[model samples]
Target chain A: MSAKKTEYGEDQDLLMKKSDRRTFLKGCSVAAAAASAALTSGCIPSVAAENSEEMKLRWQEFFKKNYRLMTQEEKDATVARLERLAKLRDGLDVQMGSYPPLKGVLYGYGFNITRCEGFMECVAACVKENNLDRKTNTQYIRIFEMEPGKLDPGTGDGQYYHKVPVENKFYMGTQCFHCENAPCTKACPTKATWREPDGIVVVDYDWCIGCRYCQAACPYYGRRFNWGKPEIPRQEINLRQHYLGNRVRPKGKMEKCTFCIQRTRKGRLPACVEACPTGARVFGNLLDPDSEIRYVLKHKKVFRMKEELGTDPKFWYFID
Target chain B: MQLFLTGLILLVGITTLFWGRARASESSFLDEVKKSTARFDNRSVPLVKEVTEDTVLSHEKYQGGSFRVLARKKNIERYQCSNCHNDKPVTVNRGAELTHGDIVLNHGSAERGLVCIDCHSPEQRDYLEDKKGRKIDFDHSYDLCGQCHFRQKRDWIGGAHGKRVVNWAGDRVVYNCTTCHDPHSPRFEKRFPATYSVPLD
Candidate 1:
């Protein structure tokens, strides 16, 4: 009995040593993260920063699994970590949505060329809704004021600085078309971006290597890369975020429109569609036979941009 | 005119597609017209032969009918016009100051010479009147607008034109034509865009 007791005591001591080594390694990582953050941001209080929750979160975040491969628990953990990080870094209580795509729902958008009137309300709304980088004034949607008889957007002026619906000039708004046969997803070496079940093309910002290969492969100029860290004002940041949508992205990641997935997956219209005053923007389930998008597809003389490329873009343009 | 021609062609196509069903329901369609005419009290507006209000109004089994035309009655600034425009004349008459001084009637072209009384009911100030002397409720202003813009009305009903409020899925509630365009001044004026891109040059 005494020998057994002595053996148990020895096991306890060994366990103690192992735990001590783990604590030391953890402390070292936290210190390293805290130091790097302090050097980069230069705002964190040094003494408390080493032991801060933020440093531990940053260290954990670096080792997170790819979003698609993560199990439900892992996804939830990452979301919680992200929310905590948002609070710790920016004092934001952001609710990051992780809504799965609804069954039998494939979204399609219809743009009325006759009604757009070159009003950039959609662009303005998108920027606000998506929490686009205000410093760079990053805009996802662009309303091109096309010259009369020149329907080609390549020749149109996207930056018309005067009163819109300029007499004869028609307007065309363009964004990420969320093509059925997306070349961007094929071009992604890291498999960072891919089309969702409900037809939104999304990027796992954490998985992206910032190669910009997807951007190059895109024929519609859909993707935008972060050259510097996205600087969004705290007050201006949209509190309602999605894991793959409008969540605050880190530096050196690619982002484009996800048809406001944070809202759309919850049965809401895209921000740009809601903001269009002239009712030019039409969005609905392409699968629904009675949907406005389907009616437009059947009745209207609809055309898709870059159809020759076999992109099979879901977005359609129609004139009155 | 070109729009009308396109609409006519499309209408022909629609008529052809639904020809059998439409033919079988001809008697019921006539009965529906008679019913609506009786309900209106006074009906002189010529109903479009191709389309009818019954098809648009009824939540028919053929069409997935979970949609509503947005009600405009609640939002109107000055409702119950009969309260002020009662039979009694105002004792204090402020000369040259019309009751609705802000109103500038410019609906049709200047040559068309459309006055307030042309659309606004002289008999009942609250209700709008079509060319057929039919009184239309403020909530159903689309009925009044449809007298001239039938093609647009058809498109709106079939979900081709106009805005659907909020949701893209589930029940659709569409805005009235007057919600976007001022009935008095129907044309959208030229305005500066809300935002612009940074010059890429």
Candidate 2:
């Protein structure tokens, strides 16, 4: 057969190789289909809810393959099912993006150490944009307030209540750095977490086994596990989502910052950077020599949180 | 040995010229980037709200290196100073109740304080006056700011000191100085964070 192209520019020959594995996975799928058919046709006794649209969508979601191995058709089908499921369950018409990484773009972030005033604006923006669990107050970004005379963050306080920018204190913000040599991605037993071509570290929620191995491996405390089902207010749910990024995740899965993949993939600034009133946060294509991140690297005296660990974090901190 | 030395000199001269030419095309480089990233107009993706009241740096002073800045006039509460300060002779009334009482005029150091007329033109209230007595438009207030804060101006020009709006790519539009900092009171005020972190035990 003539070779056809896929989103990643992979040919049909490569897809055939992936389908070979799909055949092996079909054993589990066949069983699920059998059970689903019995439940739908009343051959097997089940509650009324079992035959509902949400239940059917869950069955389809259960048998889905890893996001990486899915073909273009499969990806589209998965996104469609999720969209339909959101409508069925929450009565919310949500759009889920399965966009591939943009060509010739490597995202990087710049945080101005001097400019940050311990304002948790980035954290608030992240929580809303990512639709984070409000029950546990899950926040991906942390702004640490540090004392003067030392640059050490170990003694810094991530939790400070009172008026901010207290006399001699400085603020430093931290999140998933999307490191080049990420230990968290390496420690994922199921390969559920991996870095995209554009340098965003993404977690496939369905594929993740809730191992928590990645959490232990991360030196930056970047990964967060959902101990219980995420409870988001119906009104506050961000309708825009990305499959690998901020799509509503089930309990027992791992999630972290994907640099707002839903927004950045569309060439928009990450929500944190957008919400920053001080102009302290900078986000841009690292490969573009003329990008603001590049200019910051060239002109400012910048440093990462921990260089000894050799994570090669794309996130940087700079002071005037 | 003589041929090698001549070749070395020629190579150095050629390299210098190429470097100079590349340095001169900084603005053109941004134009090219904007054109190449034009394919980002994906219909499936909703377009980000575009800013319209934006102005570019002048080619005469900025050497053709233009970047987008939000227009200040639109945000200004009381614009067209000419509306009130119309072509009338200036009246110095320290005794009369102040027209602009809200203005604190706390810019500059305690000893070297700035009055309204220092930056604002008494002769032409609508326009700002630079150190050289040049009339500067409110839209291009960066020029007026660059007169004193040249370092910050240089950084802003290089995309370091300011915030970019809308998209990180294509047609770079940045917030001008007055957008973030009040020209009269430039320092940012300390305020409470949006949310608090988990309290430490």
In the order shown, the candidates' DockQ scores are 0.25, 0.26
Q: Candidate 1: lDDT of A216?
A: 94
* Model 2: fnat (fraction of native contacts): 0.54
What does chain B score (TM) in every candidate?
0.63, 0.66
Poorest 10 consecutive residues of model 2 chain A by lDDT?
Answer: A1-10
lDDT of 1 by residue, B61-113 (tens): 21345456666666777688887789988655753454777877778777885
Task: Please give, for residues A1-320, the per-residue lDDT of candidate 1 as tens digits.
Answer: 23323543564465466556656776787678768766755665664555467767878887665676566888888999999998887778999967677765678899999878877999999999998888888888888888888867889998788987788788998899998768898798867787776778899999899999999999998788877667877788898999999988888899999999988877778999989999899997776667788778778989999877767688999976
Location of the lowest summed lDDT over 10 successive residues in candidate 2 chain B: B57-66
| CA deviation > 4 Å runs, candidate 2 | A1-22, A39-52, B1-49, B52-65, B87-98, B199-201
For candidate 1, the lDDT comes to 0.77
CAPRI-style grade of the A/B interface in model 2: acceptable
Query: lDDT of model 1 at residue A91?
Result: 78
The 0-to-1 C-alpha lDDT of every candidate, in the order given, reads 0.77, 0.79
Listed per model in order, the count of residue pairs whose N, CA or C atoms clash below 3 Å is: 0, 0
Candidate number with greatest DockQ: 2
